[model samples]
Target: MLAVAAGCGGGGTGADHSTMNRRDGSASPGAAGHNDADVMFAQMMIPHHRQAIAMTDLVLSRASSERVRSIATQIAGAQNPEIRTMSGWLRSWGEKVPAAGAKAGGMDMADGMMSDADLAKLKAARGERFDALFARMMIAHHDGAIAMARDEQSDGRDPDAKRLAGQIVRSQTAEVRTLRGIAGGR
Candidate 1:
């Protein structure tokens, strides 16, 4: 069983329109209110989601199990839109949007992201080995995301950002359970 490290951060599903309007009576994405936590959440989650997408893509071509493929597909479906949503929020906030292909390393890997070497091993796996590896890795990945989302819920100031954090918590928590089952609770 691969042990996932803890970390301290999802989606456009939650839009708190009540807080979206500025005092000037104009609408803005993150203009309603945000703090450094919100900024950090967006910055960190983008690459995390990208790596998850990459992991799912790797399984798509190699895994023979229907369950694994389905889970991978669902992950990509949910996260691809989320990546765009976070990117948009960063743009609205005048923050630097991380490049899509950028690999997380060193301090950036604090989010429980798989290292490049881990990804390489996952990419090199095949058949049942691939499915088991994918399950273990994704479970850890989802746990890290859940931790970050919980933090965002507690510390973030933006309504939209907090809402998205809650969504990630709920959705990814469930996904983690599913992945755990696939991994035989490893």
Candidate 2:
């Protein structure tokens, strides 16, 4: 359920909205003076972060790289609170949080969510290999999140949601760079 009524504080970088995004991946009239984009952003990002947290948990249980664990710690710290913030948006919006019933969909819309199998593999890996896998998987996941945030910035109308989306883009983009550095031993 997307809370449609919450206001936002200033956060993150601004988005580039040269075009509008619709669920169909085509341009629309930009939520047409509604907070649909905020709802959508919250709804989509929840599941995305959930998967990320799950992946982080996997590495933390078995990782040998202090750097990898540290990165995972940071990612979890940033995203977990974001989930709460978005949940607040849904509550304030008076929208039902997604999947209030099975009829409602979940955050399946986020970019590169890991599967149980991927998690299993990570659990089975060791040492630098675990770090490598975590970095690679997280990079993909962040890229997906970046795409979704871009969409929200372009098509979302709520000022706060747009602001959050921009923040997500900047923060996750920097994280992606950091992960790449980890991958390259920088």
Candidate 3:
């Protein structure tokens, strides 16, 4: 018992993304009795989702491939709702939501976020260049989200946040395969 308690003392374990119930059997209202990990997950993922939507918007205007454009539309359709959901979580948690125009916030590289200059370059490229770059960048972007999601799954305290983390990992993993297919054709 002493050894178990010692091991679980720190948040570094990244386990326990399971059904968490307090002795009182009531989780914190909207925050699901969240810890710092939950808060960080919501805050970070909000901007990451925003950037993905922006990239999809670019794909709509520039990409000539019907499949690519269609996938972009699908991505925006999926992520916009998710963005709203995360925002709600943040508000419910009494945490400040990142601005819509906020940059990647932090962990930009780890989060697979594109820089302003990278976005500008993507915007300027035309035809195949656009399609290929779009797929490549988005794959990288999705990969970052997956990584963050996995972290949340291991470390987050909120049940909703951890569940969403698992979902993100699954969906984005599939999307990465699709993106790879799209990039392969080029």
Candidate 4:
């Protein structure tokens, strides 16, 4: 019976202690419940959504077509609240809420974000030219957001975070199709 007791005790020798405690040796209540993917999704998406809001603001000022203006308004309405929601999640998780003006160069380029030059060009464009550029750029931007949301759905652990990710995927996927139609001059 002693031999059996010792064998069972040995099973914990190589156990992962990180799961029980944080790196700083503090007992983490929430750390064990959430994963890296959940943290990353909020971090990256906050800035992505901020940029989308910025793009929409620019288009709303110069777009000649009412349809373009309406779309831009809708984009801003949806994303501004989402930005706040994700920021709240990061705060609750004890993670850094990325600064509003922070550059997102470290994020995946294939995630469909625009470059500085692209924004500058959009800023310079007006009327019909502005509408076309806005449509094209926003289409790509929404595609990137959809990709990140999909990753969160697959890899995230927190229920609230996963639910928000699923929502982003569905809404942004529809927006992509609409933006594409506008870009194609429909």
Candidate with best lDDT:
1
Give Cα distance to truth, residue 176, candidate 2, Å.
0.6
Candidate 1 per-residue lDDT, tens place, 1-186, comes to 111211134322333323342323234654556666776777788888888888998886899788898889988888887776766666766678888687543324456688878889999999988888999999888888888888888877666667778888887888888888888834
Candidate 4 error regions (>4 Å): 1-32
Which is superior by lDDT, 1 or 3?
Answer: 1
Candidate 2 off by > 4 Å? 1-34, 99-110
- Stretches of candidate 3 off by over 4 Å are 1-32
Q: What lDDT does candidate 2 reach at residue 176? A: 93
Ranking by lDDT: 1, 3, 4, 2
- The worst-scoring run of ten residues by lDDT in candidate 1 lies at 1-10
Off by over 4 Å in 1: 1-32, 105-110
Q: Tens-digit lDDT track for model 4 on 49-108? A: 888888998876789888788888878877777776666666666678889798664664
Question: For all candidates, what are the clash counts?
Answer: 2, 9, 0, 0
TM-score of model 4 vs. true structure? 0.81
- Write model 2 residue lDDT over 45-90, tens digit each, in one string: 7767767777888776678778888889988888877777666656
Model 2 TM-score on a 0 to 1 scale: 0.74
lDDT-best of 3 and 4 = 3
lDDT of 2: 0.66
Q: Indicate which candidate wins on TM-score.
A: 3
For every model shown, what is its TM-score relative to the native structure? 0.82, 0.74, 0.83, 0.81
